[model samples]
Target: MLKGKHEIMLKTSLGDITLVLDADSAPKTVTNFIELAKSGYYDGLTFHRVIPDFMIKGGDPNGNGTGGESIFGVSFEDEINADSYGLHKLKLGDATDEALPEELAEMTQKEYLEKQGYIFNDDLKSLPMEKGYIAMANSGPNTNGSQFFIIQRKAGTPWLEGKHTVFGKVTEGMDVVDAIANTEKGANDMPVEAVTFDVEVK
Candidate 1:
């Protein structure tokens, strides 16, 4: 288990980027990332997907945006914050509004929240998906593996809200991310010149 805040250093061919994982909000995901980094799982992987003004994606062993496994070799669920969506605004008669025991027993926490009219707001929507935000890349809900991406634009990506998992943010060196994102690419969005990564976790 992760004890406290953790920082990951990614030394890429373009340059170095540092990330501060959100352990408090996404502990399991943070721990998984740390373990993968320490084991050198991301040492030589290439950022396969690069769309200028969008984001730069990597962490796929195949370097084709199709292959990677979590440390447990299985998929994991998302860890989104609930208060970000005004769920805390709900109140009942003379009491703090909360899901009843019957509701909790019948459906998952996310389902219960949705039933209460709380749409999953990505990073609260208030916390814009600005430049340098790092999020997990998944096939669908709860499919986060080793693959992840870094937002390359200063504008907020509200479209991606509630869809992908934002597990961390770039603490420094977004210039390297921008450089990689601006690189020339061929078919399949693959960079013409390889951009590999080596991570140091602390």
Candidate 2:
């Protein structure tokens, strides 16, 4: 079982980047990530998506931003900080502008939100989605798998707060992340030249 915090070293073709996973805050997600790394699941996986001002994403075995699975072969719920949302706030900042249904106000926050299709696993500390922030990428609520991304810009991405699970932070080598993010890319935001990874959990 994972205890306390853990550090992961990601040796990329661009450079080495170090990540600090908050196992206490996101136990399941952190465990999944560590297991994947230890099994060499991320070896040779290319950074399939890169947006200069946003983030760099990878962990897709197919290297095309299309394929990957959790060690459990099932999707996991998000570990988000509920406090990030003010007690009275009702809507998310995304394009959907999804808001709490008035009819479900009587239900608890978790129940009401789950009824709305949000699946949260834990209510831990919230990490600002600023540069170097690392988080899982999902299609929607509770779809977290192997795909993950590192925020590349210094500005905070408020729209992402509470929407995705922020499980780790880049404790060192942000410059390497910036380099990968700034690299040339072809179609589908894929790097023109492959930027592969060698992940290790320590």
Candidate 3:
């Protein structure tokens, strides 16, 4: 797996939050983030979307969750390694063809997986979308840009595993994260008072 060491400090309006990036799982995504952080691209950006028990999202140039781009000035493909999360194995056996849905009965394992729209890589190790994890926020497949979100739900959001590229996790200041999440929000889950921050790569 591709790996590198990267830690960043987010000096937010509320407090500081520290994150350690996992380049082994998402090298390109981490690289993009570090580039943006170093260039001050994320300075003074607001966490545009914040759900109390879900996540806090930001890094959008528009500060509305609809705008942002990578250092390359475009969206990039998702980095999802199914093996690390055990999402590569097919749950149903070939012997169960008779009981399977008509459309799936004749398909091979790979075909079935492709039909389900799961793209993965054997070279990388994708981390799960758990509490405190940081991930790219995209509209859909391969649409990743500069926007990102931090998981807040204590049990985690497993449903997002294959959908988003998880690049890092909170290493300190989770209470600051908690406070940011619990802040009063209005339209589009935006904090009534904007929650902006400056980030530093370490």
Candidate 4:
């Protein structure tokens, strides 16, 4: 894992996971996470959404993937780009005109994305959404709150490159993540038994 100024110990019901956060690439997002963790905001939060080959998501006060707000009491913009982590060229999502809003239909993908408040940072590269990487979970553009996910897919979810903000990676205890991924899940991939975690900033 990359060396970073911020590290967090996530003590879960399953086990402990140590994460190293990159504030260089994602300053505001990292700051938001650290402040939230320090404020006891993530205590008792359950990993509400767990997919076997995907990720385990949590930090929702509602514990149902629909709640929690940032310390600023508002959503924040994404600090990422379409090309990073060795991805040379742009590999965009389904940004075809038909899939875009009517107002964005005539604009280029870059224009549409920028219009939605996503800033592309070329100087500081963001980490890929691969195994052990930790990132924010959002409903859409700039909607990041307290929700976050840990990547479990060893190959990584490349399609998420330009979408989510990957601020850190697990430096230890990935077995704990694997164990949580194996937990039985019900509707919406919600764990049948609650899997809770607390954060300790270091």
Candidate 5:
């Protein structure tokens, strides 16, 4: 197996894309990701969602945002508090003052509500979304599973910073991620072509 940080390379109609998984910050999520990759859970999967500012989501067994069963389900990982890990906020500026477009603003608020189950610290710190955030999608806290997303962009403010389970970040292959973001797609945001993936530990 590869050691330390590792890469999962793929061949998509959009070209080549590689994603680097961080083992340290998101041990469980990374382990699960590596396992799924090795099991070929991502083989022939297509990008299901492609909202430019949001993220490009895939890893579904059925090629739809809602598909994934056999090896695709994810149990609720622990809620990752940004402060607990001594992690600074990923948003920028006065975080309290900077205003973002409504669409993004709404998402930021929604992210906070999902994490309400956990107690929060009012003290603020500075952390960049680029630090290494692997955000999980969920109906509520401890409700996360296989489906996840990397923070391609930083949070607009700190109030919007908390609430997301950012288990890890990309240590390498940012170019690949950018490339995938730039790929052409169709339908409910599915990539026009297929995205097949395989994972292995180094």
Candidate 6:
């Protein structure tokens, strides 16, 4: 372990998530999220876009895709989710296999991680949203806003290898995360039942 890092436990309505904060790899990115998440900006928000077998997208405060920080506060100069870093992220077609059943996803993510070999258990302590990784929303490069997503199932979005800025991954409570993704959507792809969200970190 190079340095000591703190842990954050995000307790969502769907379930709970225990994540290790990465202060090195994506310092600015992490700082932005930690600040916003702790400030209660993401609380009570719904997963506006929930694709059952693909990914769940949300974080826009307005419940609309266009919702988020009006002013560009941070540059998505990401350390990961770039078009490089040599990652083989799942794509649309890859997610066809029953969507990895969110219940076992947290434990089964090892297989996906092993295939990429980017999963290092050392104490490098940095944001690595490799495979089954989580990332912020970006209309384009370095255009991340309040939106984010978790690759619940594998897909064929190889081009997405370095396109999205990945900041974290779902280590636990992936099943619940899946539940949120599986929720019925309305006309604008908004959750039918309004699957509310709340995060807690310990």
- Best model number under TM-score: 3
Better of 1 and 5 by lDDT: 1
- In candidate 4, clashing pairs total 0
Candidate 4 residues lying further than 4 Å off, grouped into runs, are: 1-4, 85-88, 91-117
lDDT of 4 by residue, 7-126 (tens): 899999999999999988788789899999999999889999999889999999998988989976768777785556433432233443246555545555555566666767777778
lDDT, ranked from best to worst: 3, 4, 2, 1, 6, 5
lDDT of 6 by residue, 1-202 (tens): 1123346665666677666655555555666777677788888887788877667777778787777862236434434532234333433235455665554344333345444432332222334434356777777645676787777665523445555656666666777767777877887767878766766544
128-188 per-residue lDDT for model 2 (tens digits): 6788989989888888889999999778576676677887899999999999999999999
Backbone clashes in model 2: 0
Q: Give candidates' CA RMSD values in order.
A: 7.7, 3.6, 3.8, 4.1, 6.7, 10.2
In angstroms, how far off is 186's CA in candidate 2?
0.9
Give the residue spans of candidate 3 off by over 4 A.
Answer: 90-118
For model 2, the local distance difference test gives 0.81
Give the distance in Å from residue 93's predicted Cα in candidate 4 to where it truly belongs: 10
Give lDDT tens digits, candidate 3, residues 1-202: 3368688999999999999998988998998898888899999999988987899999999999889999766888788875666544544355364587766665545445446665667788788889999999998878889999999999899767667889999999999888999999999899999999999988
Quote model 3's TM-score. Answer: 0.87
Which portions of model 6 show Cα errors greater than 4 Å? 1-6, 70-76, 81-84, 87-131, 155-157
Please estimate how well model 3 matches the true structure, expressed as its whole-model Cα lDDT: 0.84
**lDDT (C-alpha, whole model) for all candidates:** 0.76, 0.81, 0.84, 0.84, 0.52, 0.60
**For model 5, what is the alpha-carbon lDDT of residue 31?**
66
- Residue-wise lDDT of candidate 5 within 74-148, one digit each (tens)? 464443555643334333322346687654444433344434664333332213345234565554555555666
> Which runs of model 2 end up more than 4 angstroms from their true locations?
85-116
TM-score of each: 0.78, 0.85, 0.87, 0.85, 0.63, 0.68
- lDDT over C-alpha atoms for residue 74 of model 5: 49
Residue 52, model 6: lDDT of 72
Candidate 1 segments exceeding 4 Å error: 82-128
**Whole-structure CA lDDT of model 5:** 0.52
